[model samples]
Target: MKLLLLTAGSRGDVEPFAALARRAAASGHEVRLALPDRSGVDTTGIDARSLEADFSALIESQGVSPLAAMRSLRDVVRPVMRAVIVNAAQAALEFRPDVIAWHPKVLSAPLIADALGIPHVLVELVPVMTATREFPAAGTVTRSVGPLNRLTYRAAAGAGAMFRREVDEAAEVMGAPRSRRSSAPAATLLPISPAILPRPADWPESAVLTGAWRAREATTDAAAPTPDPALDAFLAAGPFAYAGFGSMAAGDPAARGRALVAAARARGIRLLVATGLGGIAVPDDARGDDVFVTRSVDHGVVLPRAVAAVHHGGIGTVQAATAAGTVSIVVPFIADQPFWGAMLHRRGLAPAPIPRRRVTADRLAEALAAAPAFQTAVEAAAARMADEDGAAEALGVLERLAGRPRNDALRHP
Candidate 1:
């Protein structure tokens, strides 16, 4: 089967699709990945194409403030999203895939697939679709608002509706008439650990809760990691804490880094900080003999060695920390982050989340002090999730969807 996978956004959004692409290729399917330019996701052993947008650069250049985002929505965000849709449509024409799987950001995939008479799958990293009372939609309220939880998903749907014009434009560019069809995917594949957030009872049968998509070689019984000698020495020094804010550039990064360093120092432990996407800036004054700062390090190599990880609550980071059996201290910046933090806390995996605005040295130190209480639960959850192969599960779903007869004349209901 020929599979075309489309995704946009930062490394977190792109990496999961890369994992799925690799798995599909390994399973004897032809896979092509279309993602943002310079996404930096390792897509070895797969045919990867570049979409025109660069979500990472966009985030880094413009801080994630609601006001700034709204101000630039028309001028910047729309054009970028339009470019992604057009590029994805172009790739679909070239690949002529049997199945199309896409991240939510690529809203044009379903229309392209419909035009091509193939199946399309929605690959959600978070449970934003498929409304349920289990929890509020991710990126909305972190805690449930009783019966109102189901309403939160409407906001996610509205977000997609905002790009309806782009979707229609993409269809025309693909030389297919504008599809008035609902554009709902044939299948929804969620690459989230059921152990972290179980499948909600209200989800449709078309949705499958696959475990977290991870590279088999990276997490499986592969050879021991060979981190840099400095990092290796730091881990050997003593129990250190890990801090990183992936792809979030909301506030003063230098101050945030200083707070993290001070908090770790207050706990009398060493610190290893990653300045990912420049959202964290470890000031020179804060860098002591006990503090190590790097632009990048393998989370798989470092998190397991840390006593606890202090990070922005990206689902990827959340999954990484949990899989390493490392407790977490989530300082959420924005969008689905607080949701993950609150869920982890509810599951006995971490302390209560600290909103990024509320983060301080004292608060972080307190969370660090509280970390040990959750270690046993974190380890147990990690053990349970160990048996999961999210990529394989998602590939299976795509294959099944591909086997179904094509709907060449799909129309909106």
Candidate 2:
């Protein structure tokens, strides 16, 4: 089977799909990943392609920050998203994929799948796409606020309309019927487990709650030369707190770094800070044998060894922390991060998330002290997750949806 996967956003958003693509390829399927040129996805085994756009210019115009770039692109390229969808559809027509799997935000892919008469699956890393009464994650305003919700719906409808217009234009260019585009029965796959979020009464039966698709990281060989002896020595010392905002860099990271340093000192924990995308400038005077600063490290490699993890609550970081069975102290900056943080708190896996605006040295210290208890909850959750095979489960669903016979007769019989 040929599978075409589409996604956009930061590395966190793209990495999971890449993992899934690898899995599908391993299962003897041809997989192609269609992502924005700026997504920075590692195209190792899969055929990774990009839409027609100057990604570097987009990045520069939006500022070097990935968060800023995403917001800017969303606002500036609202129309372009339609073009992207049409282009991806055309690509799929050429590839003749057996299935079209896309991220939730890639709304165009669904439309394309409709046009091509192929099965589509929506993969959601965050819980924002589905509104469920069971989960308090979706904002009340989207459910209530009649006028506001209507407006939001209208905006979404408008975007869809614009996308249709673009698809018609592309069809005209290709000498095809503009009105022939049709939608298909879609499935939504969520990375969260039912343990955290039970099947909601309002949720569609098509949506599946699969555990996170965590990528396996290659083990760093002991024979490999250490990149930094100082950082190496710091890791060799007692377990330290891991701090980084992932792709969301702070406007004033030095001040934030200072606060983190102070908080670590207050909590009597060593600190390893990631200077995100050149945003965090650790002061010269702040450097010490106890304080280690680096650009970044593989979260899979670092999180398990750490006493606790502190992050901006990005989904990838959260999943990495969870998979490592390490407690997390989430400080959400923006987007769906706050949602993840709150969910963690509700699961008793972390303390109440410290909002970025409310983050201070004292509050951070308090959260750090409370983090140890979360390890127990995290361990229990990891144990349950370990028993479930997310990749295999998702693939099974996909195969069934694609009209292929199930691998196991016992389950399907």
Tens-place lDDT per residue, model 1, 80-153, is 89989889999999999998999889888877887787888888888897788989999999878999999998
Candidates' lDDT values, in order? 0.86, 0.69
Question: Which pairs clash in the backbone of model 1?
Answer: none
| lDDT digits (tens) for residues 1-413 of candidate 2 | 78888776667878888888887888888888887665555677678777553333443355344456557655655544654656676667677777888875465565566555567887877665565544433322312343343233233334455455666665654445666644533577887665455566667787788877754443323233346777667777787999988666556778778888888988888999987554355788877777889977767667777888889888778877877788889988776677778878987989999877777889899999999878888988767766666676787778777743222321100
The collision pairs in model 2 are none
Best by lDDT: 1
Model 2 residue 46 CA deviation in Å: 2.3
